[model samples]
Target: MSFLEKPRVLFYLLLFLIFGVYLSTVSRTVSFGDAGDLITAAFEMGVPHPPGYPLHTILGKLFTALIPIGEIAFRVNLVSSFFGLLTILLIYGIIYKLTKSPLAAFLGGSFLAFSTRNYFLLFCFVYGLALTNHLTIVFLAPAFLFLIIVTIRPSLKRSDLQREAEPKLQAEAKEGRTFPGSLKTFFQELFRIIPPKIIGLGLILFFVGLLPYLYLIPAASHNPLVNWDNPKTWYNAQELSGLKRILTRADYGTGRWTSTTASVIPSGRPAVYQLLFFSEMTFYQFAGLGVVLLLLGIIVLAKKRNWIDLTFLLSVFLIPSAGFMIYTNLSYTDSAALSALERFLIMPYLGAAIFIGWGIKSAADFLKEKLPQFDYRYFAILIFFPIIFHYANVDQSKNYLFYDYGRLMFDSTREVVIKKDDKAVAQPTKA
Candidate 1:
């Protein structure tokens, strides 16, 4: 029996129920910041030519047309909610495909659904920030997905890249014919136990995975997650120069030293003298874990020497993180990487999660060889972190506001319309 069929249905039904309840009772708190702006842009413009978010604004406006855009709160929040669910499902699909661990996938999905990061954005985060959450989930999930695809192929032997292994690994590659030496084994592991002869459908989903990154276009107009433009909040992207440039840009038209520090701290030196630019975003510890896994996977790859695991690790984790590091040096605020590049690079996270889960499974397997006490129960404990984080996130769902607790964040009066700030205008357009 397929475990996914039942669990996914249950999850979907629960998501619908919870979302319906949230909208019905607490819908009053539904938000509109950046996403509303995108929707507004969509109504004003069409495909390929929306103001900022060509992806979200167009999509959100189209959807809202079917529903009611009358309420800024509900419409915007719902759009993100829909994509958020898609992300959860996508994660499951990747885990199932990559790790072949349905239990791990279920646990991973539960953890993501209840994470504090997601919770704060969905419930309490401000408008634009909350909408960014959609991007985070959308692109991140797919990035992980494609990374899995790319890495999975290499895990098989060279001949398997085109043909099937002797047997099917997952249900998909059931019809492969195996021949040759190491080549036969490689074909079996990537797409299926046998080789997956089909391509169109998988290819579509793989490319479809990248669509969420479009929101970054309009997102740049503002400081994104942190108020980097606010001198106080610069370096939110983990670049010292980024903070300096952001405030410098904010000081447009007025060259006041207070507004723009220019040479305030000298090049090659930090303005604030901190260890790193961002907090809560960098995945130093986790990345380290991935590095460790890569070294180990390389050893396992000796006989198999699967480039997929190695590529998955290097490309997903190292590449993106390295990109952020480079941005820190070259110093372009417009192009400056997110401080949370490590987090946003969800491919790495997926790999890490897979490897970590696998490590748990492997350890359990090894211990089982020695002692009977070690079993899936040990892995169950390993799965609890994300689950607890997710649930804790949901409990405080209503209080989180997408952005900060400023008047712009929650203007209950409705009289204080935001026109002075283009970003303020952009907030509700796509939400």
Candidate 2:
């Protein structure tokens, strides 16, 4: 196929199928809880402290003002669904950039877009706004990935740094004598790694510098997650504490004990482990097997000294997943109940995928060189299997999947609008 001719047709065909499912699943007749509240909060300009998202509220208001639909519910969710597509596209672009292979990129975007959690949330539910969380994850994942690629992609050479550092050296050359001793060493190393003139005149953008902001974006300072300043609601902290205690525990006694199936408390997170350390959280929890693959992948990336695998390790180890491990193992009672481990780390999922893709591709390429015409198409299929599996699991009648933010908007005005008269009434002056 020359990696060029007609693959995008397949890519977009997949996207259309996803969109079609989303369109068919919207529940026009029945409205639900939080989805309606988001719409309501939009017109009213705010929402209850602990769980509200101001940026999301502002977006909801803008949609309602323009659409003028009787039910703002489906409309609001549709917006996040659109961003979900944007997330998919961005991943597609980045994966293309990382692999220089169109098929790999398509597979990467497909995996992310159809990730069971991502798919169910983006396509199946009224909680269109809820998809924003993963959209946030997918979106910044690329920006962070871009940052990584930009920082290291072309592999900066020492000669290039010397040329860029020209002006400062010119000053030293002109003087033909000792500049300040402290300044001499500084510029020497500066000239060694970066061009002196460019270092002074322009900013050197690096991965370590800009990435912290992704984590900070979700913190929402000034408009803190809760009104911590007010003492009357002080016990809101305690309420969060109590709620965590109740829901996080695993009671095998709960759920169906007899229905042809059994559920366990899941003392471990297999996927988190598998994706990070080479051990599946549960299914492939064998000793030493995963560790060897983990080391082999690490050695491949390390031999090349590439940051892709390192970033994947960080995402797997440090970035918080929307799963039970964070609630149970990484608990910090005072923080947002579900958001304790670090949603800020969410910025790196794309980078994680990129590095993992590169790591796998690079390893396979090296082995193929030794194996005499080893075909790697099967490797591609296996890597993409996760995406296919996720789509199947997440395609549960689309309506059941999302968290329903429109339900928040639907009732915002009724729940919050003030009923005061238009004209101002005069009050007596105090002596």
For each candidate, what TM-score against the reference?
A: 0.49, 0.47
- In model 2, the runs with Cα more than 4 Å from the true position are 2-14, 21-36, 48-52, 65-70, 123-303, 308-348, 359-388, 391-431
For residues 1-431, write the lDDT of model 2, one tens digit per residue. 64332457646755785577545543432233344444444545433222234456566567667876645655555555666676666766765665565655555555444443343233213233332332223433543565666675344555655455556667766777445743775567657556677665545454443343232223323232222112222223533322122122111122211112322225566455424422232112212222233344456667777765455554543344333243234323324422322222223343444444454556557667998688655454543455444444544344432335434533554444443321111122222
Q: Please, what are the lDDT tens digits per residue for candidate 1 over residues 46-120?
A: 221111334555455555577764444445455555665566566666655655666555555544444443432
Question: What are the runs in model 1 whose C-alpha is more than 4 Å off?
Answer: 1-36, 39-51, 62-70, 111-304, 329-348, 375-378, 381-383, 390-396, 399-431
Candidate no. 2 TM-score: 0.47
Candidate 2 residue-wise lDDT at 258? 19
Give the number of the best model, judged by TM-score: 1
